[model samples]
Each structure stands twice: as structure tokens, then as C-alpha cells.
Target chain A: MSKEFIKGNEAIAEAAVRAGCRFFAGYPITPQNDIPEYLSKRLFEVGGNFIQGESEVASVNMVFGVAATGIRSMTSSSGPGLALKAEGISNLAGARVPSVVVNVARGGPAIGTILTAQQDYLSATKAPAPGGFKCFVLAPATVQEAADLVYEAFDIADKYRTPVYVLADGMTGNMMEVVELPPMRELSELPSKDDWRVNKLEQDGNFRSISSYSPTAEGLQEMNEASEAMYQQWDKEEQRWEAFMMDDAEYVVTGYGSSGRIAKSAVKELRAQGIKAGLIRPITLVPFPKDAFDQIDYGRIKEIFVAEMSIPAQYADDVRWATKSKLEIISVLTSGGVILETEAIVDAVKERV
Target chain B: MEKSLLIAGFGGQGIMLIGKMLGFAASKAGMNATFYPSYGAEQRGGTANCTVIIGDDEIGSPVSRRLDTLIAMNEPSFVRFVDRMKKGGVVIVNSSLVQSKVEDKDVKAFYIPANDLAQELGSVQVANIIVLGAYIAATGILDAEFAKQVIAEQLGRKPEMLELNMQAFDKGMAAVK
Candidate 1:
């Protein structure tokens, strides 16, 4: 129960280390450099390994190599860097390697800007890889939550035998807040890698190889079906979201990550002004808490506002897909690495209500 | 209750540090605080700013369009952010660099010769601390004694500069009264 003030990137890195991540590899990028920088010093202290890779492609491959040994490994990058790691991410997903990939996202299309932006939602949720494979995406609104989510991402990745993404924007990556870090986990507590890891081949005297390739068509179909099943299970068990002041909300504002935090503030202020505005924040962006959308009282809620720091409103599409009602889905957006202001959200809600 | 403050100045003015120190002290006092700096290329020598929010409960948004208070260390900062303060909010300015007067009638403005006071105290590098001390003195957002303690802890490695910083803080605090 000890609290300390720390930046989100540094907090996530510390949480990963405490969660028994023994190896880290990442290329330097704005807003996420602190993760590799902090781990370069911390992992060594914990008898772990760290590598400053030559490029994002090389760094993610390093993580893939580390994860193949059946140990917790991680890599981090921003939007442009994430684009570079796409091939490696696909390899991790295809090989069913349980590794953590952190994206402290900035504006994009192509190296847009280094400031805060939620532009990577589509890239992270829809297509993180070349194939149709998926990654578990966790979006944290605050630094404390970012640390907690990063700590939990390892277990989720291990359980499903897939890659997990801690999707944070530059604001969450760079902001400082008081966080109560989770206790350090013992190495012995980690799940045994005896069954699958390539290192165990020597002890078991069995031929085991980890690769993304499936030689036969039937084998590829089986792999895809297994991945689909894992995604289904995650949708059933790992869907996380928050509903604020929605009991009698007339207008429900929805967002995720940094945008959600700002939208919540606007909803609170709108309530103070006698307007019945509420918020639904999706914590897990991949299996996105669609149930939260279903629980909304459509009889009371007349409209839904999707607030995001992206002009195209990438997250709003998911909201639209989950929502069944014919209620208007309005988008309140700000792009180009600019943060969505509370006043703009409040004004948007006012206009609709 | 929740309070939000914006500290703005040139990149080398330690604007981010001031925001971090305030956030640290607020969190130490058992309040939830968040500090977000304006990042990117502007951090070299151009204008830099940060937003700090302190609340009794969990903070929702770290950035706000209208702030409770603003600390401006230069003319560009004052001109850029003065209109963003809420009505009746306090604006603390560095008189040595910012010559413009606060024009908003509803707002309360206090100008401190922070650079001059820090120079008189033997170092202009501590001008941000002087402005911070003045901010605490004028708004009473946090206890002056607690701020001094945080300052000492932050600068523990540089014991020689600690005394000078304290002197500058005291001088700035006195200037506000």
C-alpha cells in the first residue's frame, strides 16, 4: 500500500518488471523511451536481460525470441514505431508467443506528430498484424490503472497463449500521477514453461519447434479456429468497462483511454448543471465491453456521444457496432496530436441535450 | 474539492519541474494529483507548459480548458494562457520578464519580480521556485512549509543551491504580501 508519484511509461515498465518480465527489447521513441530506459537499469537488477534494439523490427523480434523461451518478455513503441513492428507482431501472434507489446501512441497516418492522440485505436484493435490474428488490447485512462493493467496483461497473455497490448496514448504515457504499485511477484509463482518452451526440449528429449508456419491447409484452419476460440473466451471473461452516473442518464457519452477520462469530467460538469449526462468507458478495447453498451437504458438515453482525440473517430465505429438502438451516435473529436478538451465535450453534450 | 493549475514559461525556466513539485507535494498530502507536460520539439528552447490537477477524489481529466490558477513566467506564456483562466481565478506573473498587465477585470492578478528576487538571492536559476513560493503564498493551494520540505527533498543532491533556493522562495513569498 505504498504510493509514489511516477510517470505512466515508467510506471508501466516497473509493473512489467514486478510481474516477472525478465527480458525487454525496444527502440527509442517519443513518450515511450522511458519504458526501455527504466527497464535497462531495472531488469539487470532483477537478474533479467534488456536490449536496445537497432530498430523496431529488431526489437519486437528480440521479444519474440525471449518469449519463445517461455519467459515473460516485453517491447514498446509509439505509432510510427508500431507500424514498423507490425511484421514482428504478426510473428508473435502466429507463433502463439505470450509477450507484452506496449503502444504509447501518438498521432499517425505517417509520423504525424509526437503529441497525444488516440489515432492508433483502429490499428491496434482491427489489424495489429498482416494476417487476421488479434491481440488483447487494454486501454488505461490513468497512470495507476496503466500500471495495474500492464501487470495483469502478462497473465492474460500467458493464459490465452497470445500477444497482449497495453494501448496507451502519449498523454497517459507522459503524465505523472500517484500510483500504488503492485507487490513484486516471485519467479517461482510464474506458470511453468515445462510443457511448451523450446528450452524444455533438452529435458523432455522431445522435438519441439515454435514457428508461425502451418504446412497444411487443415493445420492453418485449425490454428485460426483455435485463435477464434481464444478470442471468444476473452470476450466472455475479459470484457472490462466502467459506467458512470448512467442510472438515469439521458445522454450517454462513450470513449476509451485518455478521451474517456476527459469525457467523464464533462459528464460530471453537465450533471452539475442539471443535465443527465453519463459516461461508458471501455477498459478492454479488443473484446470491447459490448455488454456495457447493451446495458444502457435506451428509454432514457436519447443520444450517444463518442469522444475521441482522433478526427475520423475510429473508436466510434466499435460503439456503433455494439449499440443496438437507433439512437444517434454523435462524434466529438480532436485530432493532430491535440487532446480533447472538457469544454468541447460539455458543449457537444449540451448541443444534443 | 479539485483545483487545476497551469504553469507556463520558456523551456529552460524549469516550468515542468515546478508542476512536478506541486503534484508531488499534493500527493504527499494525501490528495490525488496528476501532472501532464506539453511534450515534443517545443521542449528544446521554445515555450513549455504543464497542467497539474489536485483533487480530494480521483481525477478525471488532467488537462482542462479553464484552469483555477495560472503561473506565467514570460510574456508569451501570459499572453497565450491568460484567457484560459476561469473567472475570478488567480494569475501569478513574473514581473521581470512579463511587462503586460492582467486586463481581465474579474480575475485577481499578482505580479512578482521573481527573476530579480532570485538574482538578488545569488541565482537566477531559482526564479521558478520564487514564482512557486509566490503562488503558494497568494493562493494558499498548499502549505508554504510543506512546499519548502518538498523543495529540499527534490534538491537534496545539490545542498549548496538549497539555501539559495530557500532564500529566493522567501523573498518571492514576501514580494506577494
Candidate 2:
């Protein structure tokens, strides 16, 4: 419980150590450069491996190589870098390797700026793999949440045998705060297995091989079926969300990461002036907490404004899937570099309420 | 609860240095603290700022909103952050850069001629230290003795500039006295 000052990005490095992560592979990029920089030195001190790969493409492949060894591995990058990793990421899914990728999201359609945007939601969770596989995504709002969720990411990825991503942004990643590091005694190493090993055996007729190609049609069918079932199970078992001031509220504002921070602050100042605004934050995005929407009686509430750093329009498709009890859903979206200010949220809430 | 301050000015004006030394002192006193300097282009010619947060409890947001305390190293920073401060917040202005007064009497404003003090000490780069001394003298958030300890620990890291930096810090602190 001792006090220490730390920035959000460096705390991810410390959390990686606490989470028993032994391998880190990443390239330097704005907003998230601190993560790799801190790990490059600390990995050596902790007897772990850190590789600043040549490019984002190389870093993604490196993630595949390291995680194949059944180690807890990770990589971080921004929007463009993430795009380069997407092709390799599909392979990771096809191979069923567990890796945690952190994206300190930045604005873009193409290299927009080194600032931040939540527009990556559609790109990440709905990554355009061959057959369409889903990746679990967690959005952290506070520096504490940012640090703690990173540790959670590694555990969840291994447990689900899927990629887990912590989608923070430049503001959240760069913000400074005191990190309450997990106790050293609480450290637990992630489980490692030999099944992913190639061409090795201790007994007669026991050699095994791993490949991206399926040797049999039936084998491919069975694997795809299994992947779907696993994803469905994740949908049921692993969804997290927080609803604050939702009880007896007329307006609900939904946001994540930096936008969520601004939302909370706006709510506080608005409450001081007597406006009732609530928040619903989805900590897990792969298995989006779609059910929580059912619990909301939009018949009573006047509106739901989706405020995000990216186009709030991205979530439009999902919002339509809501078993919606009649209510107007508005979007407060912005893009390119600047943080979504608390004043903006308050103004938006005032207009909606 | 954690409170944060952002001291902004040009590179040679000493805002970043003061912010770092304050954070160093807070850390030495066993308090949670962080100091971040905004470098790169901001350090090249225009304005520069360092954000510092000190806390007793775990801090949530490291960035400042309504600062509990502030030191505006330049006129633009003073004009920019003045209205953003909480009412009754203590703001130490470097009169060398900003000669104007706060329009309101609610906020406590201290005009310290840090550049003049640095000249008196025959060390103009020590303006940051002078501002720190004035901030400490007015707010008393950190003890002066604790600052000396901070100077010792932080300066020890850079062996080449240790003696001169500490001397500058001492002279700056004495000027406020």
C-alpha cells in the first residue's frame, strides 16, 4: 500500500511483470512508445524477454512466435500500427494462440494524428479474419483501471485461448497517477503447455506438429466449429459492465476510456447544477454486454447519447440490435487528436436531458 | 486525495525545473508524486509546462483540471489557466513574464520577481528555484528543509552539474527569505 508516482504507460510495463508475463514484443509509436521503452529495460532486470521488432508487421509475427511457446506475451501500438498487425492477428486467431495486445488508440482513417480516438472498436473486435473470429476487448477509463485491466488481459487471453486487448488512448496512456502495484507475494505464473510445441516427443510415436494449414477437411470443419462454440461460451461467461446513477435516471450516457473519464467528471459538475445523468461502461467488448440494455426501460428515460472519441456512429449497428424499449439514441462523436473535454459532455448532457 | 499543479513557461524560465524539484521533494517525503515535462517542440522556442501531482491517497487522474495550486511562468499561461483555477486557489505569477493582476480578489495571487531574484543570485537560470521558494513560502505545502533533501538526492544523479544546480537552488530559496 505504499505510495508511488507513475504514468499510465509505465504502469502497464509493471503490470506485465506482475501478471507473470515473460515476453514482450512491440515497436515504438507515439502515445504508446513509453510502454515498450519501459519494458525494454525492465525485461532484462526481471529475466524476461523484450524485443523491439523492426516494424509493426515484424512485431505482430514476433507476438505469434513468442505466444506459440505457451508464454504470456504482449505488444502495443496505435491505429496504423494496429492495421499492420491485423493480417498477422488473423493468423493468431486461426492458430488459437493467446496474446494480449494493447492499443493506446490514436485518431485516423489514415495516420490522422498521434492523439486518440475510440474508432478502433469496429476494427479490433470485428477484425476481418478469414472466417471472422472475435477478439476480447477491454476499455479502461481510469489510470488504476488501465493498470489493473492489463494484468487481467493476460489471464483472460490464456483462459479463453484468444487474443485480449486493452484499448486505452493517448490521454489515458500518457496520464500520470500513483499506481498501487500488486503485492509481490500475489504473483502467479501463467500455465505453460507442450501441445503447441512442434516435432518434439519424450516417448515413442509421440511427436506432434503445428501448422496453419489443416491436413484434413473434417479437421478444418471441426476446428472452425470448436472456435464458434468457444466464442459463444465467452459471450456468456465473460462480459463486464458498470452502470452508475442509472437507477431512476432519465438520461443515460455511454462512454469508454478517456471519454468515460470526462463523462464522470461532467456528471459530477452537472449534478452540482442538478442534472440527472447516468453512465453504462462496457469493460468487455468482444461479448458486448448487450443484455444490460434489456434492463433499461427507455420508456422512462428520455435519451441515450453514445459519446466516444471516434464516430459514435460505429456502435449504431449494435444499438439497433437492442431489444429497445422506445427511446432516442443520439451520438456525440469526434475524431482526430484532441481529448473529449468534460465541458463538452456536460453540454451534450444538458441538451439531451 | 491527490492534488496536481502544472507550471508552464518557456524553457529558460524554470517552470519545468521547479515542477521536477517539487515532485522530487514530495517523493523524498514518502508521498506519492509524479512530474512530467512537456518537451519536444514546446521546449524548442514557445511555452513549456511540467505537470506535477502529489497525493496522500491513490490518484485516479494524473492530469490537472482545477488546480489546487499553480505557477504560470508566462503571460499566456497565466491568462490561460487563471480562469480554470478553483476559486481561492493560490497562483504564483512570475512578474518578469506577466505584469498583470488577477481581475478577481477571491483567488490569492502572489507576484514574485523570480527573474530579478535569479539576477540577484547572479544565476538567471535559477528563476525556477526562486518561484519554487516563493510557492513554498506562500503555500507551505512542502517544507524548505525537505526541499534541500530533494536537491541532494535529485542533483546527486547528475554529477557534472550537481554543485552549480544546488548552489542555484540555495540562492533561489534564500532570495524568498
Candidate 3:
């Protein structure tokens, strides 16, 4: 496959189309607007449906509706918009709808800025909604990874019968890079949903009922237990991370998405400066890659740096939990649309190393 | 080897296109490249800029804090980004719009009247291509032929414009030489 220089949002959108996604419903938002903007025309050209929903909430619900028919579907938004779509996302999880929801995250506690940030770490991985269910989160640090992960997300979602979240940031969404796109999935090769899809009643005569509600407490308990079981399976099998220059690393840096990407350069600079610094970039954020921390030589390592674009450091909590707070953890942070500089990260590591 | 450059100017000066062309050319030449634009409210009559990084290694960050090259299309762009450049960096200033001069002794500076060159070519819009041509000739990081190929593909829809752009590219290369 020939690589082409394309923006992350466009790559993701194209990947989704290649992955057999026949439907997309989304509202406009900065940073991530390109995803839907690309899809608006791209999807239609593939004979797929593209709807610019009245609102983010409506868009997500529309995705939920499309997914119920056993069609691979998606919706995308930034921070504020993601918040609006939370209820629909929770509904998708509850109904076990295999769909992809992309959160091209931007700065915010609430409508903070249109610039990039990693503030949605907790919201995406921890509490996507009021439900006890979790969306399998894939955080991509590069445009190539963004396309690859989004291409994989549809399959991951179908396999588990759950919503998969591609947690990208504004930087990744806006930046253009050379990427080798995945080959298009044959529609015939796509998994059959005849037995489960509601719209297939004429063919299967199953008369399937898909709803987030189970009616009775006992039924709900059974549903929750089933969800719990699936989650356990995901946690056991899906934790993915990248260990960069960790062969003899005495200083470890942990981050995901854009933060992780920036930290990688920082790791290189630190290594150049005679510091054995390494980075653990989590490719999967929900199943949190906690075991990557185990690779650290705790006996010789100096410290751990938790870098993120969020102030008060939401991602650091996972790093702390993963390492069990055994070593001193330093946080390298920037907030409210400010980008994390590789030089600053190197400087921060220099202080400790 | 890795090279990072920034192209800055006011909106509508084709600032973003310059970065995209460089990135696409690098990619076509089988190298890794990242093009990150300063998007959003800044595009509304404000200064528009984009950073392009080309390297053999996997490019990590989309942006570089210390740029190896700076292509400033106007005075403000030169003023804003020159200091962020690494020492001994290559700077291509559009002398037609920029009154300020590069004072850094370590920096390899090229003062090109890109607008004037574009006027000679009959369109000021091709001024960016002129700068891009100078960048190629100055850096030699990428083959000039690859850039011409990318421009042909990018401007393929406008056949009449393609001939002018090709001449503009040649004019730019000659100016640097």
C-alpha cells in the first residue's frame, strides 16, 4: 500500500469507511470537524448514509439506531460535544451495540477551548457515562496509528458487542502525516448480524428486541453480570502499550495520545543527554496497559514521569495505580489548549535524572 | 537526518498550502513527514502558520519547539518565528513584504522578493511556490523533481494554472541558485 500524507481526522474517517462502516451521524466541532466533514462526502460516495444530526446527542443516538440494525456505524465530537453524546454512548453500551464513537478530545473542564488537550482521559476510560459499563478505549499517538486503530475499532467493537472509543486529541486530528491505509473490508466478509439485528426479522424471524433497559432488576442484574464478564475478558486480553528505549531504562515516562507522542521525543533527547529515560505509551487506554509498568527495573530506576496535557493530571492516576505508588512520580503537564513541548519534558526529566 | 521548518504569513497567502506541499513531497520521496497547521480563530484575518517536519526516523511530535528552518512570508511572521529557530537555522524571508532583516550571524538567510517573482510570473498566489522552490534549492533535503510532481498532482484540476505554477517553481529554484 502506498503511503499518503493525510490528516489524522481524514485518515480515521477513511479507515472507518474501509472497515465497512455504512453510517455516520455527527455534529460540527472544532479540531474534530474534519472527521465528519470528510465523511459527509466520502460516506455517500461509498453508498453509505451520512447525517449531520441536529445535535451531538441526536447524532450519537442516530449511530445507536444504525448499529441496532447490525450496520457498522460511527459518530465523532470533541470534549463538549462528547459530553452531550454521553447518554447515547451509554445506551449503545447498555444495548451491546457494536459501534465506534470517536472523541477527538480538546481542552476542557467544560467548553474550555478549541485547542488540543488530554483532559478527557478519565471521562473516556473511567466514566464514559453513568453506567458501570466501559467503552474499550484506543488512544492513538500518530496519524498512522489513528487510521490503524480506527480500522481495528470496528472489529473490536463487533467481537465484543460493545462500543469502542477512539480517543484522539486535536493535535493528532489536525496534523497531517504519511500513512499506509488499510485495505477496504469486503461487505460480504463483514460479520453477519442476522440473528441479532432487529431489522432482519423478515429474514431470520427472530424479532430481536434491542434496548438499553431490561425491565426487571433480576434481568438487569443478569445483563450487568454479562457486561462484567465481557469487560473482564477485554481487560485480560486487550491491554496494549509500547515500551520505547526501555531496555535498560532507569527513568520511565508514561503518557498516551499526543502527550505520549511528545514524550517519545523527550525520551530520545533524555537518552542523548546520558539519561536512561524510556516511555510507556499506552495504545489501549481503557484496558489501561497497567502491566507495562511491571517492565520497569524498580531496583535501579530513578523515577517515573507522568506527562499529559491535562492539569491536575488525570492520566497520572492510572500510572500511580499501575506502579502502586512505589516510586516517586513526577507529572509534566500543560493545560487549556497549551501544547506540551518536548524540550520542557526533557528539562523536567533532567531535574530528576 | 531530520529537518523541521515553519511557513508563516497572514491568512489567504497560501501559507498552509506551502507546508502541505513540502510534506506531500517528502512523503512521496519515501520519507516521514508531519504537517501541523495553527488552525481555528487564528485563521480569521490573523497570522496563519504551519510546521512541517521531514525525517528518516519516525517523526514523534507533530510540532518542533526549535525549528531548523523558517519561511516567513511577511514581516510579522519573520518577527514571530525567527527567535524560535535553532541557531544556524536556514531562513527564507519574503523581502517584498518583510522590511526586517535577519541579523543572526549563525543563520543562513535568503532574502527573496517572492511577491515580486510571483508578479513576474503573473500571479501573487504562486509566491508560496516560489518560497517552496527556494526551500528545496537551499535545503536539498528533498529532490526538486519530487516537489514538481506533487505540485502537478495538487494543481491537476486547474490545467491553465499548472503551467504558471511550473514556471513559478522554476523561477523560485533559479532565484536560490
Against the hidden reference, what TM-scores do the models get?
0.98, 0.87, 0.97
Against the native chain B, each candidate's TM-score is 0.96, 0.84, 0.97
Q: Per-residue lDDT for B69-153 in model 3, tens only?
A: 9999998899999988788799999999999988889899998999999999899999999998999998889999999999999
| Candidate 1 displacement at residue B16 in angstroms | 1.1
The most accurate candidate by DockQ is: 1
Off by over 4 Å in 2: A128-130, A184-189, A199-206, A216-218, A312-325, B1-4, B12-43, B50-69, B136-152, B158-177
Predicted candidate 2 versus true structure: per-residue lDDT over B112-168, tens digit per residue: 877776777676776787777777776777778778776667666867455656666
Model 1: native contacts recovered, as a fraction: 0.81
Residue A318 in model 2: lDDT: 61
Residue A123 displacement (Å), model 1: 1.4
Ranking by lDDT: 3, 1, 2
| Superior candidate under TM-score, 2 versus 3 | 3
The CAPRI-style docking tier of model 2 reads: acceptable
Regions more than 4 Å wrong, model 3: A202-206, B43-45
Query: lDDT per residue, candidate 1, A278-314, as tens digits?
Result: 8999999988899998898777777799999998889
Candidate 2 local accuracy as lDDT? 0.74
